[model samples]
Target: MLINDNQEQIAIATYGLTKIYERNIAVNEVDLQIKQGEVYGLIGPNGAGKTTLIRMLATAEEPTKGEIYLNGDRLLQDDTNPHLKQYLGYLPDDFPLYDDLNVIDYLDYFARLYKLSKPLRKQRLQEVLETVNLENKRNSPIATLSRGMKQRLSLARTIIHQPIILLLDEPVSGLDPIARLEFRQAIKLLQQAGMTILISSHVLSDLAELCTSIGIMELGCLVENSSLDNLYQKFSKQQILISTLGEYDKLEQQLKNCPLIEHWEKLSQKNHYLAHFTGNLEDASELLKQLIKADIPLHNFHCEKENLETIFLNLGHQQTS
Candidate 1:
């Protein structure tokens, strides 16, 4: 279940959304709700059904049983509601590009396909090119661009029609560090544009930096879904780092004396230690006061929360065999 504000408008929702093959249930009954303008990250191990759920939402694949909604309107796979397609931009992991066409021409082609007026197409092409930082390569052939550029070009094509919601699957799969950083920047720009984006990626660190909320999948079931803040509050372990100029032994003894500290570890740096803190800010302050009273030359003291990756691994969700 998703922990969301009741007042927030839901841009995408699913009810009992499921998919099945001959013997395997690719996606179990999943009830998901994503608020408008939210960057919702989906993470899980291989064969966890993340792709299947995304495909169903993109209308590329039909669900065996379930209902999908956008802005409170039911979405049907049939062509009866063409307007619904206009509201969504779906980019699969393997996105095709016209290698022969120039960047501008390629975007123009998709814009025309979406029935954008010539004047509007011209305007939108420039906007998208700028958004993806591909303005310099507007006239460059798609085949000449690097892997990262190709991905950004594909993203530009996806948004050429100005879709309100975007569904992206493993957008940064095989790119190098620089390429991945570029892609992340483009996604941030899109988010600032107020597009509700659902992204699935194995890169938890990127998701940690990008997503407003996250949903974890395992064996076709959504086992966890919550806002980042809420997830941190509930699952993140707090630790305190203390750097002192005084004697290490004295600092260690002081930490051992504190009941609020579960345990402490000596760091590689001189006179620096990490303590597993179990109390609130007030308790931390009291501990700091005690250290000062003991004449420990404390130079730095601060709390560090567990990151998304640590919390995810600690949850013990494994990939399908």
Candidate 2:
């Protein structure tokens, strides 16, 4: 069933998506659909076939089996499909470049490849250069630019055609902290431009920061598919941190006595403890009330949501064990 059917905000779709290599199943049977104008994330551990999946979606490589639709048109088959090439842009994890060409020359050359006319080509070149903040280096040779610059240049080329859908494979993989931040800002610009983006990254924090919807793959299965917020809620372990005025020894004993307190540990000082309460938050609250009534000083307490790394680790562990 096509969940996104007739939705004006739909971009990519795959039915029974599969890619095989002889006896090895690179990507197992999968179903994926992404809405337009959202930063969707394809997250997985190393060699989880995220790259291969993105490649198939980009129309660069054919899938062993299954079908992909871009902008509601089946990919790479019909030239007359109005929703074909014009609706797509793909940026690989490792962007290739022409070392001999300068920045402006490089972008202009790609514009011509996308069949833009003379005046339109210049306009697009200028727009993309500014978009990626490469106008200052417009005359610089591609070989002279930094890795970050190269990534930005590659992005400029990807958007030179003004593609409506973008399949980016680890677009921010190799960059310094400042460069990564700049790259993130560039992505935000793309998002505001209303580009349908599918970004694949092994970096959990970066993905967590940029993506709104996410799909997690492992062992050739789409183990999870939902909005990032929902995934966090579904898999997250809720806990709380607290600091008391009195020593935590009494509190530690209280913690051990409560069956509802699944796990907890003392913090740096004698009066603080980071507590993990899995079963019932209200029961944990009742325990806290009892502690307060018993003269166990309660200074501060706040809920702590599990971070994306913890979610990933827990998922990976569940899949294995």
Candidate 3:
């Protein structure tokens, strides 16, 4: 983690970032500040400039106009700063791997590219292998590894240099559920180890579960940027699901009398009811108490916060509106 004299821990910062290619403005003016050790999720539809923004941050491409600062040091336009290279790691959506090399050899190749010394390179290789849960397959040939294993190997290669910040683009694109879970766990471990990560994923549920904060981009513009909680509050409506024992009619009647509920509906001809509720948790609890006092015979009740997918769609609608 890096901190300046003001005691602010910022891992990456960009101001008025923009990218232009002939007639296309791939990325408009964007300002972002990511704190140290925060797992930030970048969400948006296809061709939303998510990849362009990531590429600029990774130093893989130059921004048309903007200032980029990593750990408080201004990045050069040429992006040839050797010192900055050690602080940033980038894993693109399609990671190229050497099928001929064994797992250890492949990782060793990248470590050498990073100019790590012999002892430190060997230690980092071991650490990264363990971090990605590939220690047992260190001797296995890359060609024989599964897709999930290959993805993990790519991540190991990215982190072998132990960079402080990582930029990942759709890392779990083609993985199965189990593979996605395993990869997510690996990312969480990296976050715990104090690496700030900016990851873009189409998997909204996964992002909701893993990211502490999120930024939503739309058509080369950043429309939303905030913590996950704040995003939910801004874009989600609070709802509650209630299931009654056998008294559906009674439950519906009692809930209709409650002032906290803005609207209520019986779901799909089922006995379960969902209500759009307005109020804090205490108010919700009081409503539950009222239902119990009225003998509504509740079997189950739970509050539902909007998921990432729902919030994303709402943002999309807002964009067009």
Candidate 4:
């Protein structure tokens, strides 16, 4: 279900957007809506049509049917609606960069292409370099940078025009742990700056950390779309971990009495137990109260919500070849 927050303005909306190649439907009547300043994560398997949808949104590939709107303005592939392009910045999985040009020069070239004035170009170049943490490599050749640095540079180029909406397709495809961390930090900084971002990546952990909302696509169709909180409330199972200083058997007996607890198992650690809780916060609180009343010598009791991967798998939308 699409979130309808009347107070928030829609940054991007697509009505029955679709793309077809031969008899194969690349995107099947997708009606996507993203609010301004939202970090929307798109997730699916390799052949899920995420790239096709994003390419259509970027105006890089024209959709065979449907209409795209940017801030209430219809986005046209033709030259008549050229101004709509300014509000968008798209970064594909593989982007071409000028290997011979230094970082600053390459950014300047794109800035000029976007028709930014000389003064604005200079200001934006510096700002984007700083945003991506590439200030030190401003004069370094693109070919000399590491894979992570190159990705960051590509991102800087995408945002050099300071677009209100950013589209990223697998922005962290190949990078070491440290590099991915750095790239994630850059994305957080961008989110803090209030740019509506839509990112499609196989990294569910990253998406869990960054996305305000998530959409799951399968076989060219969007099967799930919801705000992260709602999705969690609806699908994520709540688990409670308890550590007691008292005997494990006594704790187990007390847990068995509680109807809210579906089941529980002893942890590898002594006197630690993990319980599958089937209730809301208040029920969990009542369980804690009952445990205390039973004098189980509870030392640690905390809830652990199911992570994104667990939720995704539980929803039965596993990737297919």
Candidate 5:
């Protein structure tokens, strides 16, 4: 498991943040807090307000109610604050591009817009190209780049100004597996450089591999929020997989009286059973000893934990039901 410091500085925070559209609450009241240097994943099904929440964070859409803060400064009250623009970067799922411009020129244009000095812009352009692994394609026309390449290019543009916070909405929507992995690597690099990121994606596997923490949204409400470890601990079952060399009927008869075993299921045709063992490591060891004393031939014993998908589904079901 990856360990992170809870004492890290707050990067983005929203309190009672809400959005309404024509009497519809697109985004109900949401209270989100993300720490600096952490990669936070926002996950939900279609029309779950994931994009709307991100838009509010990016300041692209104003909230009907509530407050938002970035680096301890109020964001809702400041439209002319150049510092907000300089410190926050927002990338939507479909990023519009200047087809006439090549990769290098595209990055250079944004750098200039940020008022970066000419010499510094040149340096930053090279750095971002390298960061996104687009250095070799710097001279390629934006229209000629592949889909994955274009996505990387868009990310390069987002980070070229060295934004302290990034709000990415489905950044890896249509990429192949390898391309998604590459994108994950680029985001890790940025995290190492101390950029706090809030990313939304339906690709739970990618989010599982990348995010330090996750927030599950359902029906425009934040249903679950916790670190990956905490979520796992909450949903994980203390089950044991035991393989025995004896007949299943005999094993069942011998073990029916075991109070510590809550339930059991046969795994395939193999001489294996998954038992819900409600016990710690020491208790499990004792149970194994008891089984041995009872003349049961035990070949293997190990604990199992529920995976991310299961936890995600459970949370969604709990909210909807």
Candidate 6:
């Protein structure tokens, strides 16, 4: 379904994207664009190709240099579109099923291998076993479930063929914080059924609380690709923290008469203060309206939004220093 049913985009564009094996370079050249229903996150570490650029955007390899645009069509994953496998639904960080197929006959054997018809494959296998709740483990025994019910029966076979773009490798890797909160409420019920995910996880706070745009592969190269508030408003550096209702030596002598606070210190006692933002937010908002017109007792203030594991350890310590 080459997206454009009034543009419900599910993007994954790339260019200059490279990959190599025997001779090294796992990923490089990478440029990116990921939008659609946007849950995009692909952080790095562990040989940082982020699983070979998500196995070449789930086309399952083939791209020593590249192009990938899911909803904007231009397909491949051995393209021969049988509705492009109902719009991709890969789940590969080892999501192989059929241990004597049980959970509703393994989602009615992939909804009749996506051929669907037998009463719409029993209505999309009872609607993906109630969107992965696994309705009473629908006749259990995929080898006695539980590794979080076999990761919610592999997300009910990656949404029994209703795939509107999903590629979730490491989908809750070996759960058990109550099955990773029931597989994060079955991926927030597949993003409220609008689906368009592209997750990868080494759990960075569960992809910083279930992604809202991210793309940070390292060695393979597309370092950061936006929106976690535009990647901390374009690579962070807006840290403000002032906690004084009274003397931190008169708020560090009224913040050393506010010189657009390029840097300040005293992180404890005398009250507490910290500042750094020479990126000059209009001289740090005219030094916070001249400390509220010199009343000074600003009891508390905090502004620390540069977290995604602190922008993934400051971009892996600025690419290994």
Highest-scoring model, lDDT: 1
lDDT of 6 by residue, 5-81 (tens): 45645466677878888799988888777767778878888887877777777778888767777766665656575
lDDT string, candidate 1, 1-321, tens digits: 233467778999999999999889999999999999999999888998999999999999999999998888889999888888888999999978989999999999999999999999999999999999999999999999999999999999999999999999999999998999999999999999899999999989999999999999988999899999998998988899999997778889888888888899989997789999999888899899988988988999998888888888877533422
- Per-residue alpha-carbon lDDT of candidate 2 for residues 1-321, written as tens digits (9 for 90 to 100): 234646454678888888888888888988988887889998888778888898888777778889888766677644566458677788887667999999998888889888999988988888888889988999999999998889989899999999988888988886888778778888989999888889988778888898889999997777888999999889888787888888567888888887777889887786778877775667667877888877887888777788888898888998999
Would you list the clashing residue pairs of candidate 3? none
**Candidates 1 and 4, the one with greater TM-score:** 1
lDDT (Cα atoms) of all candidates against the true structure: 0.92, 0.83, 0.90, 0.91, 0.85, 0.76
Candidate 3 vs. true structure, TM-score:
0.90
- What is the lDDT ranking, best to worst? 1, 4, 3, 5, 2, 6
Instruction: Indicate whether candidate 1 or candidate 6 has the larger lDDT.
Output: 1
Which sequence of candidate numbers ranks them by TM-score, best first?
3, 1, 2, 4, 5, 6
Candidate 6 deviant stretches above 4 angstroms? 1-18, 21-41, 44-52, 57-59, 63-88, 91-113, 117-120, 125-158, 162-186, 189-206, 211-216, 221-240, 245-249, 253-298, 301-306
Give a tens-digit lDDT track for model 4, residues 1-321: 233567678888999999999999989999999998999999887888999999999999999999999988899999998778988999999889889999999999999999999999989998999999999999999999999999999999999998989999999997888888999999999999999999999889999999999999888999899999998988889999999997677789888988888899998998889999999899999999988888888999999898888887766544442
Per-candidate Cα RMSD to the true structure, in Å, reads 3.3, 3.0, 2.4, 3.5, 4.2, 15.5
- Please give the lDDT score for candidate 5: 0.85
**Which prediction has the highest TM-score against the true structure?**
3
lDDT of 3 by residue, 1-321 (tens): 447456879888889999999999989999988888889999999999999999998888899999888988887756468788789889999879999999999999999999999999989999999999999999999999999999999999999999999999999998999999999999999988889999999998899888999999998988899999888877788889998877777788777888878889989858789998887888889888988887877888899876889889977997899
Better of 3 and 5 by TM-score: 3
Q: How many residue pairs clash in each candidate?
A: 0, 0, 0, 0, 0, 3
lDDT winner, 1 or 2: 1
Candidates 5 and 6 compared: the better one by lDDT is: 5
**Per-residue lDDT tens digits of candidate 5, residues 211-250?**
8899988878998888878877887668888888986676
The positional error of residue 172 in candidate 2, measured at the CA in angstroms, is 1.5
